[model samples]
Target: MQNPTAATLYSQKQIPIGLKNTIDKTLSEYLKDEKLASYNIDNLKQIIEDSKINFNIKTIKWDEDGSEKSTSAEVASILGMILTFIIYMFIIMYGGMVMQGVMEEKTNRIIEVMISSVKPFDLMMGKIIGIGFVGLTQVFLWGILTTVLVSGSLFFFGGNTSPEDMVAAQMAAQGVNNVAAGSSDISIQVQEIINSINFGMIGTSFVLYFIGGYLLYAALFAAIGSALEQQEDAQQFMTPIMLLMAFSLYAGIYSMNNPDGPLAFWCSMIPFTSPIVMMVRLPFDIPVWELALSFALLFATALLIIWFSAKIYRVGILMYGKKPSIKEMIKWVKYK
Candidate 1:
């Protein structure tokens, strides 16, 4: 009776639900015979009991050696997704803040006073980097806190646990011996996933791509904010940016089933989508050359975009009340 939400359409759990629906509908249509309909509840119960139509499905992911993998691909995908979501939120939230701050200064005519002394490019970079530090500091603190908590918990569990308790825990992890046992299994699985992750690689790449991705998007956002007289005036420009963000996210998700597939390979190469899509591939242990190439491309693209965005900011920030078309913004980028 569980009705999956729209987001659940992406989940693999729907396979069993689809199977059940097929069987139920087929049974219902064929059970319309008057003789069958006349069967008593007891008769139906006896028929079902005697039918012996039972299914017990167990899934195990095998490694190259034919041994069961310690962690499921689905669980690994979830970890990759969580990393991507954090980066996405950081970019959007901090990048939007940069845009809003620029808009506030322009609308109040404060930038006019400030810009006479500060270069437009300097002002834009200052705002972008200043806000970026705040996000970086917050995430750094969260990392410290999480590491301490996990380490403390591990110390207690590993050092003080009794032999009997550890045995019991292993049993619970292997089977649903009791409610407490089942919970133990979940915890063990989580620990296994954590142990298997390449935090050094993921953490380093995350900081690099997070900063690079934010810089790239924030530049355009700042340019749009400077060009518009009112927030409503920016919607036309915002639509394309929003669509691009959504497509990047969806591309990353679809590539999870095949991290090395053509889609994943290409998406991770593109600077616009690579930040999100590359995170999805990190857990799968992609090659060193590929990772290096992706990293170089992202920062290179970011730097190039920031240069053009600063040009647009220089021209648009001074203009008042005129709604700049995308074509006009392009012309600003071409200025000497």
Candidate 2:
């Protein structure tokens, strides 16, 4: 009954003789009398509850945690759209960096001197990383600002929603009749959609996918910039990457229509497109094994692309007479 006795009893190598005897007596007494069994179970529950009691009990919201299950499809759909918008904005932002970097080097004729001082790969990497950090810093600042705005809006609008509103919403969806005559169908659908979205998966997939996708394109853009000695020369190379990015983005949008379809599965599995495709599918569900495999593929593809791009970058930085054709670029990829 006391803490010290309970601790000692628990710490024993084997159940102590006295405690075993007490348990045997209790079980025997309970078994012999039907009324005593109910009383015994109640007493045991009380004892366990008393022993385990803590401040956590006061804060526990068992009703919510243990409450009804909900789908996250609607939320996933919303997040996918938001992510698509952000990705395009990112392309415009960082892709502009590639063009600007090319223009800067061309104007200063610094590309000539830089190639002599450092390996083209190093210069390209350093420039890309430095610029990428700037972009990331801007993004982080924007996120913080947005969060503050949202919180402010919620506060100003009194986001303190009533529990009855939640209950009524849930009940109406389940067809609990005559609960609320005035509840809007739009509100109910919105709540259902909001409830369907899996926030955890959406957030996780978004972070990983966006970062991977960005790194992949950023490296490609940097390599492209390194290859061009003039802004005009860069345009020829720019179209293809732009097309790839646009195609991948559009493919992601198409995949959203059928999150669980075969095309979506393959699209999300491909590292180049997965960032957008997987984010779109997060609302439906991504299997753990599939996600892992997709990640592995993405990492491997990134490494390979960076390696080949570095090779291209090595020769490309020094190239100045004229723009390299596709054939010449292929030679760089295979060069020792």
Candidate 3:
């Protein structure tokens, strides 16, 4: 009898049936002797039938609305995660740009000249808003360009193949049809998954969170820049801010795995971490009330942070030659 190889097992149709037939033929021939021939054929048939089987498993998930296929959920989860990471990186990158620009102006003594004409609050708000708009413009352009390129590619190359067909082809290439009905079910639901995503909600929430999160952190970053006479002096103040951002990142990651967990719920509520965490959770079925509350808290907190940062910025920008301690910063905040 020929032994089945990996290629034959995965690539061949009716694999178990073919193997059983071959085994039966081989066994009958080998047992042709009278002593073996006396054995019960019924028993042998039962054994062969019992052994002739293949496994194909499928998982069906149910949400509050109705039954959900795993493939659709997986696709949504992946897209949400990618967007979350992109937003997180963008906030950090652009926030740092604001800090660096402020430091450069201060270093060159250009701020003194600028300040001669402008109030510190106005100057600080101008820099923050200007840099933030630049970041937002870049993000908007990137979104538009990405959409155009992706749509063009799909139109040019995607051809008549439906999403299901595409998924089936990919699975067939890998030779693993573990899903039920040989990927047919998953393929059928691909369009449904695509349609289920709330692109409008995501886009709106992303823009709001991106701006809110960036403004919240950028104010503090600008305050840090104003306090330090040299670049090195910024490090001591920046460490705590960096750690808070890092915590938000980790919280976002955790939310990806457990979107409805208590940790994710609280993270999405906190102003410091909500920007990243809430965005991560938005793709899922979070309640309207929770989202509304999170937004309100974040908006209020951003205003409070900006007000506090302005106080620090006014005093810190003028002080020179010596690095101020946390105690001294409090005194600056208290100064009328």
Best by TM-score: 1
- Provide the TM-score for each candidate, comma-separated: 0.74, 0.65, 0.72
Candidate-wise lDDT, in order? 0.81, 0.67, 0.78
Clash counts per candidate, in order, are: 0, 4, 1
After aligning candidate 1 to the native by TM-score, how far in Å is the CA of 316 from where it should be?
A: 0.7
Cα TM-score of candidate 2: 0.65
**Order of all candidates by TM-score, from best down to worst?**
1, 3, 2
Clashing pairs in 3: 164-187
The true-versus-predicted C-alpha distance at residue 334 of model 3, in Å, is 1.8
When 1 and 2 are scored with lDDT, the better candidate is 1
Q: After superposition, how far is residue 331 of candidate 1 from its true place, in Å?
A: 1.0
Model 1 lDDT per residue over 21-48, tens place: 7766665555543345466555764575
Alpha-carbon runs more than 4 Å astray in model 3 = 1-71, 149-188
On residues 159-273, what C-alpha lDDT tens digit does candidate 3 reach at each position? 3567667666766765555554444544455434544566678778888989889989999988888888777777888899889888988888888888999999999999999
Worst 10 residues of 1 by lDDT: 1-10
Candidate 1 residue runs with Cα over 4 Å from true position: 1-69, 156-192
Give me candidate 1's TM-score against the actual structure. 0.74
For model 2, the local distance difference test gives 0.67
Candidate 2 lDDT over 1-336, as tens digits, reads 112122223553777789878977776555545543556576764565578845521111122368543344445677777777776667567757865785578557788887777877777677767776776776667667756865564444333554357556656665544434334433443444454455556655655665666667777876777667666676777788777767777877887778788888998788877766676666665678988888788878877777877887777766766777868887988888
